[model samples]
Target: MKPPCYLIVLAFLPSFSFCEIVVKGDGILQDTSLTKNEATPTKPQASKPDPAGDDLILFDNGDVMHGTFGGIQGGLLWERKDIDRPIKFSIPAIRQVVFKGSSGVVMEKETSFITLVSGDRIPGKIVSLDDKSLVVKSSVVGDLKIPREHIKSLSPNPFDGELFYSGPYNSNGWMILDYRKTKEKDKAKEIAGEEKKPKKEVIQENGKVKEESSAWIHSGASFYSLDNRALVYPDANMPDIGRLKFKAKWKGRLNLTLALHSDFTRVLPAEKKEEPKAEEAEEIEDGEKPKAEGEQKPRKKEQPEKQDPAPLQKERLVDFRKNNAFQNIAWINPSKRTHADMFGTGYTMTLYSSYPNLSRNYFSETGVARTQRMASVRSNISLSEGGDAEIEIRYNRKESLMILFINGTYAAQWNDLGGFPGDGTGFGIVNNTSNARVRISEVMITSWNGMTDSANSMIHPDRDLVLLGNGTDRFSGQVIEIKDGVALLKSAYMNAEIPVKDLSKIVLKKSTSTDLDSDDLSEDLTWAKEPMTIIYKPFGKIRLNPISAERNLLSGNSPFFGEITVDLSSAAMLRFTEGSPDLSDWFDDL
Candidate 1:
């Protein structure tokens, strides 16, 4: 493969660069002349208009144009019907832009509500804070100043279904790694060495007695073999994480091994013991020394006894050897009830942790295995010193790495792991401490690299963007059609028709790109021959001036997966106009 002739990365853009570039009701706009699709992480190929309604492009000079969108090039919005002479509108002159679909983020306008002890709820952001009082910025009223003691709690605005799960504990799908009899059995395995040993037998080969090598006897520990109820996800339908592989079926399972927590595995410290009182007096300064008989010196206060680290059980097992770095597998496999997950099938690196130091222990599961093959890297920055902290573990399967961030601090990165079993394969967490607890506030499984983050920090990127806010979460894409309040949202991930009621907001963003003309921009146009309405049977209807389809499945892209076959099922139905051609008969035409 040859490198490109020019590779340019734009760090900054001119002021109001995207003002003129307009995104019509439809999110599809192919800008060929400016930056090519090869500019960055693969440019988006906008789908042609699917006839939602009469789309109006509102301008600053109080001008409105109603027509189907052809494409946007050189910061000009093109209006096309039969494509005679495409009407081009400058992107800058555009003022108000309205979309026909769901915003996909804010279903309804929401705000954080602060409930007062007086039973009054103020909806807004906690803008200012002080020891004595705080202020809340609300839309209905101006800044509300209330005593800190008067406020009860702040109720978070209800989010869409996008929040997977959050809280102090998820006891549903997690399994505890308990080692009771396994502890004794594990020690015996280390002594005798063997997951299982077949009865010894002698065989005669060529009239001579021969013996089999005893190497088959394994000297490793294993987990109790139970139909690991804890090795899977709590929910059946979760986003698949596309990072970390080398084994199959490693889905939705996190390395929660409670044994990983020190509070459960290490020994606790001895309690502080009171010091005995002194019976004899001591000398003070040379001149002030006590010389009187029966005179005693003042007793100093004894410092409180310091406590030691909490006690924890030693249940984790690892066999670190070569690239066969799965010493954990070696120990886990020996257990009578321990069932190794599919991810346990190959080489794995194993690293130990040290809480006294702030660092991550990196290991390869397949490098090697032995009693003590590899050493674990422990971080001096102790999570042990404080209470529960926020931890986010993300794996980018494309890079085959596991990254850990504690309290938004990058703690560790495990790149030794291989690729992911599948994209969006999620993971879970396991608690090891007996009394201590950790809570999860929320989890977001996203494909795009934080381009349109709505929660925590609502950073909306200015674009011809439409957010299809699903009940669970949302993805940004082009709005294909809006009929009867149901909008067909098209993106590279998945395609679906969502009721406009479920939408957060469908916004046509302001553009700042310079107006440059492209000659071949028309080549990407899809000219519709007959006007048709896509009867999205159950929900609503969509009109497509020129509709396109294939023999069986609808030729389209999925908002979740690229280039997916849209199964013509209960949700998908079609109707046509008076002069519309019979699609059944036009199967050959397809």
Candidate 2:
């Protein structure tokens, strides 16, 4: 059979002539024309001022363009101010797009979210439900009748409370600072003491000096860090009981530090005090009596007592050092190390990836405190090399407990024996890898009830699972119907009507053929002429084969959802390509 007409037309496109697209294991798309070198420096050059436009597109090689979205047809059409004709980009050449002024959909009071078996999540109010199909009233895309077999779990109150933040829409208020540079400055100050001249002045007095640049680059909705750097959201007003969710993609080993309840706007070095010499200490202790004899005590005239600069006063320095809050350092793969600290108390967790993958956790409360081994088990939560994972952290300061979930699996939980430290509401992240590239996006913080999912619970292979609010109560049953915020479940012992608010999660019986894994979905997309993953706003993802587009609507065919049309405005991101690098090769090369 001959190729499609659009493919024939795409062959003649001018943009394809000079641009060579390369897709990385982390799903980053790079245009060789925009990048002169494939290797990134240990400390990258300072990023230019963000371009000005209503919409922005980020290329994989850290290049960005300010333009207007021209919608998607056979490929993405981006209209630029410098060009009269719209430039079409293949899916593999674009990282992400940020639509200016696009806010998250405001969910109604009665709204709930459903997670499909294909990993798609949709927010809507349940109209009615049965074993065959679920009718839902979506505020954005109108009513949707989702097949019952595709349903995985349901959340009655996904947010639990109002949404606090759902962005990384732009880098407007974000502070990206080079971690190494700040530490170096702090070290230099500590060694040189307060009497040393300022670095800028010293440079002027000596010779021209080079200034360090930030290791992170912000393009559109994502932040890419070349070396160690800290991305801080100083304005975050974290709820006492809240959940933080973000998607991170990185190349090479994943080493990251997540700080919660942090008040640190910028890194502040710890205060250092010099010890007095033996004679100086004795003379000071002796006061004016002993100093009279032959010492003289430099008594020409008593000038005003010298004082350190205002910013370096003892009280001010102490206040600055106190801003360092709870932080978790997580390193995956070869390192297989994790550490969490709050104030002076914390724990270190080590992991082994192989069979009997024994993990250990050791807690320390103080220097003289007894060491405690809280818990240890063989965990299956292993992060592959050069792979991406979704990291979710939920903290309940009221309960002094924090839970971590990796790729939807319960990894571990920690209870702060010293109680949750710091009342500050800021959140921050540090890229701990030296030369690897890290990309962070889709960051969202929302008020939570501080409940953990039942991913660790045991479930019968043939029965549907229902978990209660307490995080431990659960049962296996057949879900007959769901209505009026109550789930009707028929179990072996009795039929119960469980209130939705009392439930934490519901996992339906898996269908062998209907439930498609992500790997399976990616394999099917390989055959499509133009395959794209449309990440809808609020929540949800759908893989579609683009047929055509008109105005703001994109009509496409999903192998799983069949014929469908998506409003371009309702989408948060559009991914053109998928797949991770081979794990064996990555490990061997490392």
lDDT of 2 by residue, 262-378 (tens): 544122223568888899988887785545566545657768888853442111112322233211121111221222222112222222222111111222322122224444332
Q: TM-scores of the models, in the given order?
A: 0.25, 0.65
Which residue ranges in model 1 land beyond 4 Å of their true spot?
A: 1-161, 168-380, 399-401, 414-418, 422-426, 430-590
Worst 10 residues of 2 by lDDT: 327-336
Q: What is residue 372's positional error in candidate 2, in angstroms?
A: 13
Segments in model 2 whose C-alpha atoms lie over 4 Å from true places: 1-52, 58-63, 81-96, 178-213, 219-222, 247-254, 265-385, 450-460, 468-475, 483-486, 498-504, 511-513, 517-530, 579-590
Question: Per-residue error at 198 for model 2, in Å?
Answer: 23
Clashing residue pairs in all predictions, respectively, total 98, 0
Position 285, candidate 2: lDDT = 78
lDDT of 1 by residue, 411-465 (tens): 5554433334222222323322222222222233323221223222322234224
Each prediction's whole-model lDDT (CA): 0.32, 0.57
